[model samples]
Target: MNKTNSFRKTIIIASLIFGMLFGAGNLIFPVHLGQLAGKNWLAASSGFLISSGLLPLMALIAISITHSHGIFELAKPIGKKYALIFLVLTHATLGPLFATPRTATVPYTIGIAPLLPGNMQKVGLLIFSAIFFGIVFFLSATEAKITDLIGKILNPVFLLLLFLIFFLAFSNPMGAAKDAAFTASYAHNAFTNGFLEGYNTMDCLAALAFGITVITSICSLGFKREKDVAITTVKSGMFGIFAIAIIYVCLIWLGATSLHDFKLSSNGGTALAQISHHYLGTAGDALIAALTTITCITTVMGLVVAFAQDFHKRFPKISYKTFLAINCLLSFIIANMGLDTIISWSTPVLMLLYPLAISLVILGILSPLYKNDPVVYKITTALTLIPALFDMINTLPEVLRSTPLIQAILSYAERYLPMFHLGFSWLTFSLAGLIIGLIIHFVKQFNYSAVED
Candidate 1:
């Protein structure tokens, strides 16, 4: 009986993790990558998996290994002020600012809009998003049952529908993959493009923010000890990562083979809908709609619950229910801004924030190598900030993108920063900072040991 309970708990937590990560990006991005990659689909999928798969798993593992209470704990080595800032920024990014809103917008665009008549599309979206976020608000307002609600109920329904679609697609493929030319970026460097594409999902950022929630869920499941919580977190995260990897590869395969019959699409969501319509007709369409809606709902609920809990802890007077209501309200308003606009505007923020989040995760994992020295964390994060800020500037809107100052900065970075053109200028700076940090750490250790002797 105890073994059975533990097994069930593992499955529940894993499903919850998968639901958190598998938003519209999981459903759409791999398919789009496969389409653009053409014959190089495998290479592209590998890159995508590295970013979307390995990076997120690493972030979760870092959380578990470090036993971080949350993003605040994860960033505390940098300092209290910076930790608060990082936590706020991460929460905002994963909450009302982008991820949560995108959940509502993505489903409306891909699932509902296509079904609506041209004249009714706008109204349809408003109605659909209203209902979507309404459900999110309802589910998240009461946080006690959230883990079970997502893991036991919503996730299984989502998986069943998703597996059905995948089975149909794989069993009777849309068509064979033809010798089509790769898209412009994919033609030269499909892998890197695919790698960066995963950033848009922002799952790594979500993982950092969700760390506390996962720990709480584990504790609620009777794993009260810190060590047990960490161990369970890693084990549960593995199940989610495994599910993501399988689904992504299959979706990419579906997209790659789709080129034989369907035209290349602007985004993965559209490609998925089109393919579904072609293969299963109305039933396929219903499946896609249900999948999008459920996936988006799960994501929104996860973020809403996380954000509410974090804020309520920080500001005890606010109450979790109020925080949940505020976030849902904000998400609903932003989501109604339309999917394309939200996505376009999100690019700059994602560019800037991704490096910082990645740097923290890497530092957390490597902290043991440097003996968990705060100096290492501080310097490495500072160095990472420079290139990430410049990258952010470069991704600005056209009006600000071509100014002389911005162009000059970009030019200078391109000339001196390794991998600047490939969107990893942070890599060179991080390594330099890590080395400097190690030197400082070892010198301090040596001096201390000599004095003791």
Candidate 2:
């Protein structure tokens, strides 16, 4: 490998990863955590790094090492039928069902909604999402050009504007890093709360989906071997991780320290708006609007391309353009549900999908130890689904929640399952399944050796 060429390819691939990973939610979630975590912001953000920064990085590495064509391939150890179901559900969640729509909503909520008159807010969002996703759809239609469009062009513009905002906010300071009162949610186990909060960004889930795109970009740059692809992916990911970490820390500090001089808003968007106004006035606000819009567009483009490419390959009857069109349209309609509605509805689904996604990634990393056994994957995932199902039901509305059947199941889980109250019941069951799987594997091996003798 030519050192100079490899370095250049790494920068571009890294920018592409950063662009895919850094969406509007990335902007909002950290700031919100900082504000809520208050004086404990440092502790809380340390937890946030686990889910947001670390897990996503690991997912990227796992995908590249597995040489997964997409999420389906990454999950193939679980068996074909299960892999298809996982791929469909994961892509749906990452695309129209949740993350994709949020891309349009976040920019509008933070950047555009505040600018519109109160009466026009609803109409403003509709028009904005339509136009926002329209541009995303157009860009994503030509999926092959994604690396250049995002990595070389759009990401540079976004970073320049973001850094300017960061510089201004730091130079003036929002207020002293005040000892803020912890919110009820973060009042206890603030670190864990922050860790959970990072889940809302869904970066770990998206990283797996986006990994195919990263691997393709690397191969395009001439890294053809599986080992080279994995190595280069990690090196490229370091660039994106550094950028995300610096930005997240800055945003969290901004939120944590803003309470002394600025009243906290209902959400991260409002808080960001107030801070921008305080520092840069209308000009600063405009810059924010531009930064958020660009970031969201790039993210949406990545998502649309990822979903379309994977689904199109799976179902050759449907063209990539057809799926891209469908995803873009669905995302536009869902996004118009408004930011609050989208967040509320998407939260439960995310809670359910996250544990499963994390389990698969971890299993993939540990595959070597188990010799990539299908039995291990099946047992672990099957066991995880029990608690994961209950977790989803717990997020349902009062009408469904009031059902005796639901209550009975939840009560049983809470009583029998360790860490149920803390939202990690799946961990216990998953571990048990792993142990069972190992025993079965070893016992079967012993029997086979005896037959051979």
Candidate 3:
């Protein structure tokens, strides 16, 4: 391909990456973090960028370096059974159980729910989600060019609307971001708090699933070699993530400045609505609602299709359409629990899954060093899993966390694990696991070579 054509294709791929990963959680989390971090927004956003921005790019590179077809293949070195379990859990979290459902709830919470009376909000959500998923189902069932639809059409429109909001906010400032007061959680450990808050975006998890689509797109554009594909992925991924990181900073700054007029919101959706209304009134609200819904539709369709296709491949007896319907139906049911409830429940799950996912990403990236050995994969993942479970238990809702069994587990973790209170106890365990696994791998290699001599 010519340089001009190659550059165009690369840009298109970058847009696709941005469209796929920047969905409901991406819209809300940074704004909410800004509100919490207040004057410390810069410190907090740096941490947020690591997990929400850099990690997703790393995930794509991991898939490319390993040449894994999808999430299952990415985890395959751990063992087939473990790969299957990880695949199911990752898809479940990304699909009906959490992320997909949140797609429906976030737009409703931001734009639609505020217009309704208190009692009508629940019914409004039910009606809105039904229509939302109905559209998703129709689009996914068709053999449409979803990648082009999102990258060429919807993402640009969403960006235009979002940029308008940002421009207006910056032009007519609510207050200086540095002048905003920090919430108690962010007062002392804003960076750590922001790091954990980044988990809410779920982009890291989505990156693993979306990696195949990106790689395939690059290959179709005449990049036949593995090295070329990996390089292209890195180029496109950097562009996509750089865009996302910029938006995250802007949204966080918007949130911090909005504190001049509005109090801390219960969630980012609420904060976004308040800001929109303050600047543009009903029109701003409508624009934000449309922007959110458009971004979310792209995401929900992607998640549903990915889930159905993967599950159908695993169980050939089930049709893809059948799996699609099941996912949509389950997501519709869960979305009605409302945005706050979904977020509250999803946190513990993210806490549990992130460490495992991060470990896998690191392992995949470093697989070249270990020669993709199963022994290393098994050891690192096994050690990571233990602390991950504790992280989950520790993050559970207060009511469930107060139970005797859960309390006992948290007490033990807090006492025994470093950085347990900061929600990074897994870091120590994962490092230890990797060291031990590498030592064992080298020792085994040495023994076999000696015997051969």
Clashes of each: 0, 0, 0
Worst lDDT 10-window in candidate 1: 173-182
What are the per-residue Cα lDDT tens digits for candidate 1 across 23-142? 986788888888998878878888888888888888988898788878888889999999988888888888888888989888788878877789997788788777888888888877
Question: Which candidate model has the greater lDDT, 2 or 3?
Answer: 3
Per residue, candidate 3 scores C-alpha lDDT tens digits across 170-253 of 899999999998898899899989888999999899888777667666776689988878888888999988999999999999
The stretch of ten residues in a row with the least summed lDDT in candidate 2 is: 174-183
TM-score: model 2 vs. ground truth: 0.95
Q: Rate the local accuracy (lDDT) of all candidates.
A: 0.85, 0.85, 0.89
lDDT tens digits by residue: candidate 2, 1-453: 889988989988989999998989999888888889887888888888888998888888777666676789988988888889988988999899889999988888888877789999989999989888888888888778899999989999998988887888788885665577567777777888888888988999889898778887889889988888888898988888778988888989989888877766778887877777788889978987998899988888888898988888899999999999999999888888888888887777877888888888888877777778889888988998888887777776667778999899889978887887777788888888888887887788889999999
In angstroms, give how far residue 318 of model 2 lies from its true place.
0.8
Per-residue lDDT value at 180 in model 2 = 74
Residue 179 lDDT in candidate 2: 77
Candidate 1's C-alpha runs over 4 A off are 178-180
**Highest TM-score model number:** 3
Off by over 4 Å in 3: 219-222
